[model samples]
Target chain A: MEGLIDGVLPDAAELPGLVADLRTARSGISFVYDVIEKLAERYELSDAVMVLDHPELGRQAFRSARRPIGEASAMHLNVLECPEGVHGVPGGVDPVSASVAVELCRIALDLDLYRHDSRHDGLTGLYNRRFFDVMFRRCASQSARYGWSFSVVIFDIDSFKQLNDRFGHMLGDRVLQVVGAEMHHALRSSDVAGRVGGDEFAILLMRADRENVPAFMSRIRAAVEANMEMSVGFSFGIAEAPVESTDPAELYRLADARLMAAKGTKR
Target chain B: MSVPASSEEVRLAPLGDSGDEDESPPFDALELEIRRLPGVVAVGWHRGEAMRACLSVGGFGLSALRSRAVQLARGHLDEPLSVELSDVEGVFAASSVASVRIIDILVAGGEVEVRLGAGHLIGTGRAGTGPEGAALATIRALDDLGIGASIELRIASAVVLPSDLGLAVVVSVVDRHDGSEHRSIAYASSVEESAAKAVIEAYELIGEQSRDQAQSAIR
Candidate 1:
């Protein structure tokens, strides 16, 4: 493949094709993998690594290698503002085309980020109601098909309107943000949490029933207490599928009814 | 699905549709479509509560954007979605005016001094402290520039939006010759600065309205 790079700037001819590939990339990791594959094929490099700075994901390194190695080569191709450069690039590569390729990679990452932002709540960083419902249905379908069990929890901040009226909405928003962060930290990757309403939250726990929920709630409470300056309290209701009901809407209603009962006892 | 077509009806709409296989999310497409409507500057869910769209001054496509926003939000939200349409013409228009600039503002003891600059031209005014005083100083500075006679500016209110949304100052200026009130809301990090800009934008709005009225009369 050394003959492919024999020209003064052979990579310049590859720019358009690289851009088209970047355009069709589904995610940043896949795009980096494709770039590494292309570099390996075009330049006969055994390995490649790309270090990227993303607004949301921060700094991350993606690596591709033909075989397990003790150490990667030290060569770097400077791309965009990535002064650290893309490591493992061969010496003969064109700087101009390499920079353009990296820039296209950056734009592709941004497009994915926008796609993510749309599905999440801006203030709390949880799945918004719309996306949450979609995910919930998928989980429910899987459970029904395979006879797996899961639990649904619905809860809201107690006397939240009073809290907003007394302390103002800024403090109220702060409480919500802190609670959201706590919920995000408390749940496992398989579990999903969403901001279903103002000061309201819902969680879907996979492979778990109501019996396994208190520990998760305790973790959220502990985190909230550790992070927040003010005392913020909430009530929750949990119902398990197959044990409670198979219907998704019925599960939510059961959880909500229990939530109302819990709130009633608190008062 | 068919959305409620009532142009004034505002309801809670959900976020994005994840079913889309497109590169960009549906929320972004909705936002882009709304922004493309005449006079819209920004569109988003207001802190995950309501859909809020900010419109530019003299913008004409409110009804169109409102309906589209409702349609876009239909399946994404389950609650009563309130669509908030705020006129941001005053704050945004001041930035895009090209000529005018608020050079300096000094509040000392019981008085305030304001300096207005447009290219090489400068105007100065002094008044008492507070938003009303800020508006007074701005009008005086405009008078110094030989442009204040067309309207009489007054400070209406300087208030903060909930959840630290920022401070906004409302200025109601009367077209002295025509006896019509032109109310403008300008937002800034500080109340005094918002008041100063609100007064200036109200003046600009009055000038545009008068020109429009004159053209209409001629036609």
Candidate 2:
């Protein structure tokens, strides 16, 4: 019988890898609770419950597997015997055990949330520079391995200082918000855009080329120009991977040089 | 003025009747002669009823030669030199133009000769009435200077003029080539007087070389 039950259960080895891939704290904890419920089906546990502990919300039960039994308390465990003498757990019972499971789930969820928040920008919701550095290195490595091209387009708001001087910082922030939205709209699903500095944004274009870069820049320029009320335009400098240069530092420097050249011709 | 009175002593010779075609007077020969002149570095010819030579001069002494050629030409031809100096002081005064350290002079034989460096900027706009006009005006001014030459002059250079505003003076001479000479004199500044004289001398040097080259080409 134990062998039959083991055969019916999902292979447990695959569950950990799946759980590790889920970085969202609540989602990860919820996923673990789901696996536990699936495991209980083969064993016919009288009552199975997974609870996650939230520091503020106390213990919260997230999942349960059970069968109804007579004279069980509203929140008590209902362990019933089937016709085959197998004990079955009623759903949403087993209050004490459920509470414990809820507390553990909460702890895991919180940790995942903490990790995510640490790596991302709170306002823009994009990966912060620290994460961007890691991502850039990873992408560069992949590009090197595959002999593919990757490009970074660095954009700066022109005369942002003067805008701030004339309209005050609050309006200046609104300008950034609008421009950021324009950038987001212009990027491809595969591309990543991040606020690398104040009034400066960086985008990573996977496998981009000079032929395509001008088009991309033109779109971004037109978008910003059309949407923003402020008298400003974005200056972009593109540096490609492995083609223009292989080193990320050198790529960025090339982009910077191009940007400076663009600025010289602007006015 | 105690200058030489004899024909041999004079560096300039009158524009004699060569009886050549009005427009095609063996320019190759003329260019060769102008090239052989000591101070004349380059020459260009234009074929018209009035022949002209473009003279590029290297030094100051060549200005005297330019003046003598115009004077001698006027003494022999039907129309002597006519000079016109235009208001081009601004261009003349620019440090960049002056830094070339060269001067361009236009001398008319039949076609006009404008001597400018490869890099010198000669204004050819309506504001300056074009290179041809400047050449004609210089010829008119020559007649005013009593330099006998039947040639029309046009001289324009990017050199500093001596005043805030410059003047354009035209002198017309009638029958100077046929010896029934009449002179028209119009004088403005000493600086212009010297500039016109220098351009004329440069032109003569160019003409002499042109004549020598023509003679050699035929030989």
Candidate 3:
């Protein structure tokens, strides 16, 4: 591994395969860090960091940098367990160094952000439709493994178009922001809420029964109604995960159809 | 003996000056009377619509009352029913009707005044036609009765489907002064019913008031 790092930067084509090998080996965190550090040293790079998902410590990264004089500088990266990873450089560097370093850091950070964003809505910053698909499968798999149940709730703004017309687009944006915040506040930490479309949101309730859904939805509805601008309310449709459908896509379609049914009956 | 009895007829003065009075102050005799109506639970007054009242009733009659109120209002103001208006001018022209909902109920005297109004349309389903028809209907309804006149209808407690509980009773009254029309709807229901009924009754009350006023003026 040291010899591998001492050579030229891993070919762009080969880096993925090498990373896969490292992952498969279940390489120790220190070993991974050393590999990154040695590579940075060989390339005369400013810095390198290796992060791992640890059972007890969450995600922690060990970073090593090579000074212009070839001395080793090191730091420990501490971050929350949020789905996306955070990155920043400390102290001041010259503009050129800063630009290059920042761009490099962004490239690394973006890998994580993109992974999370793929599962989240860009505008509302809630979980995206893709996230729902992924979560359905993951949750179903977990439920099958654990012999538990999972449920989903599909909610959309009732007559949201009227709101945009009466209050204008800016207020409509405010409404979404307020709704997202309230929903986040309403759910347990274990639960997941994602914005799947312009006015559509979905929630994944772990270990939830069909009976528990109405109460959960009622709480969410009340919270949203109370927190939102005057007279705004939402309609929701709920479906249990494996019970509704084993397939993730089918589960979503079922939930969405139920939501449309609820909307149709509203006078 | 002839000087003992004076011929002068002493008439009681009206509560306030007839002109420029706050027609629907927060608390007044009429407001109190509305609150005391049969089945009424709460009453509020606003100058914009005037005499908003609410009532809670035992039974599906509320829907019938809603249609009847719209009909009676049309007789006086010549404005069509909300559904009819929606069809003719498109739903947006009569958008105000959809905004009304029953909020609460109050019973005062022997009259059962259903309180209605409050809430707004969730979205813009209609075009921009303004409130001409709604305004005209309100003016006509208010013009009909002499001073202290009131109307009552039986209302069934409303039930939002999929939910078992009865929500509330809703009603509205409209009156005219000069050329301007004043209309109000009151709701008499529990806190649970507040969100659904407030918007429905407001529109009904406005339409009813406009028609009543227009008819009275014609007479």
Instruction: Give a tens-digit lDDT track for model 2, residues B10-63.
Output: 111122124222111122222222322233322333223344444443332345
Query: Residue A259 deviation, candidate 1, in Å?
Result: 1.4
lDDT (tens digit, per residue) of candidate 2 on A95-184: 333333333344444553455456545434455677766667766777778877788888788888988777644456556655555554
Candidate 2 wrongly placed segments (more than 4 Å): A1-90, A221-228, B1-219
lDDT of 3 by residue, B95-137 (tens): 1122222322322232222222211101111111112222222
lDDT: worst 10-residue window of model 3 chain A:
A66-75
How do the residues A192-239 of candidate 3 rate in per-residue lDDT, one tens digit apiece?
678877877888877777687667666666765676636666777777
Model 1 C-alpha lDDT per residue in residues B16-61, reported as the tens digit of each score: 2342443234344434333333334333343334444332322333
Q: Could you tell me the interface RMSD of model 2?
A: 52.9
* Most accurate candidate by TM-score: 1
Rank candidates by lDDT, best first.
1, 2, 3
Best by lDDT: 1
Q: Against the true two-chain complex, what DockQ does each candidate achieve?
A: 0.02, 0.00, 0.01
In order, the Cα lDDT scores of the candidates are 0.59, 0.43, 0.39
| TM-score of chain B taken alone, candidate 1 | 0.52
